[model samples]
Target chain A: MKEGNFCCHKTTERSEKEYKSLMNRLSRIEGQIRGIKGMVERNVYCTDILIQVAAVNAALNSFNKELLAEHIRNCVVRDIREGKDETIEELVVILQKLMK
Target chain B: MKEGNFCCHKTTERSEKEYKSLMNRLSRIEGQIRGIKGMVERNVYCTDILIQVAAVNAALNSFNKELLAEHIRNCVVRDIREGKDETIEELVVILQKLMK
Candidate 1:
């Protein structure tokens, strides 16, 4: 696969609306990270930049929550219904890592 | 201030090493965000992307901790020694926000 074209071994084909929403969220986060970089470059107050960083963290958390919910609602539920019980263990492991 | 040249009303001139260190961390984070965006664009598995997002969150947390410690060690300490006790309140407020 080409560099940026590399897909996961397993992929989830998100709906158009879901894909757009996720992309928009990520674009905003990318812009925020760039803004924080500019603040650092300009020697901004530590607490000020720190506040921006906190906001980015919140954004990332929200994104994760959204994606995780979709995963549970679609992927895990579908797998369990198909008798793929191993997905439960996978979900548990990832949840442990996420909650850490 | 010019478009990308805006500086904070109050600033702290970090040491050369400190400046480079902070910039490096932010650069890595910015790259990580871009990588995540690419992963999303490539329709990577939800769990894999979530794992990457968790790593980014941990990176951001480390960056905040490093900057906060420097602020406390230098800015807060200096302000207190100079009888500018209001820095304490400012520190307290930002800490509250961070903890939230």
Candidate 2:
């Protein structure tokens, strides 16, 4: 990690492709939320809106899962190999939070 | 249900307060998402971003639960009272999706 790019608290430098993918996922999720807001505003059927909400939730979950996998593969693995055992505890804590 | 406001498929007219409350919840969720996107752009730590994503997921779940409660209390119950039994099926299907 660079000066401004700490592994955990500081930051992580993602490849351009990684950055783009994460941003794209977030952008799509954001747009979905906006669309749901529009549905609510237009007084759409409750079930219809609920179904859309489920879709957004799924998209968010997908984003979380993908990011978590990458984090484990890169950051967690590198930290462990470097004998940064605290990273394991940090990973455990976040896993608990994400599960909740 | 009014002409343009069918109970399920057509639409359901929500009270002004109901509308406002739902919109407020959605707006907050939308803002939370935007904040997450900012974190990604700033190259925040992966675990940190994952935690924020979890929070957003919880917020979305809260919104879904609230909306579902209102739908049951109003639309589902009313339809049942009116002998429109199909509403029950619709409710069941949406519940399955939400849980999924």
Top-DockQ candidate index? 2
The number of clashing residue pairs in each candidate reads 0, 2
Shift of residue A34 alpha carbon in model 2, Å: 0.8
**lDDT measured at residue B43 in model 1 versus the true structure, 0 to 100:** 88
Off by over 4 Å in 1: A1-8, B2-8
lDDT of 2 at A74: 96
B24-92 per-residue lDDT for model 2 (tens digits):
988999999999889988988898899888988998899899899999999999999999999999999
lDDT of 1 by residue, B1-100 (tens): 5323464377878999999999899899989989998998988989999999999999999999999999999999999999999899999999999998
Clashing pairs in 1: none
TM-score of 2: 0.91
Interface RMSD of 1: 1.5
Per-prediction DockQ: 0.74, 0.77
| Residue B26 lDDT (model 1) | 87
Docking class of 1: medium
Worst 10 residues of 2 chain A by lDDT: A1-10
TM-scores, one per candidate? 0.92, 0.91
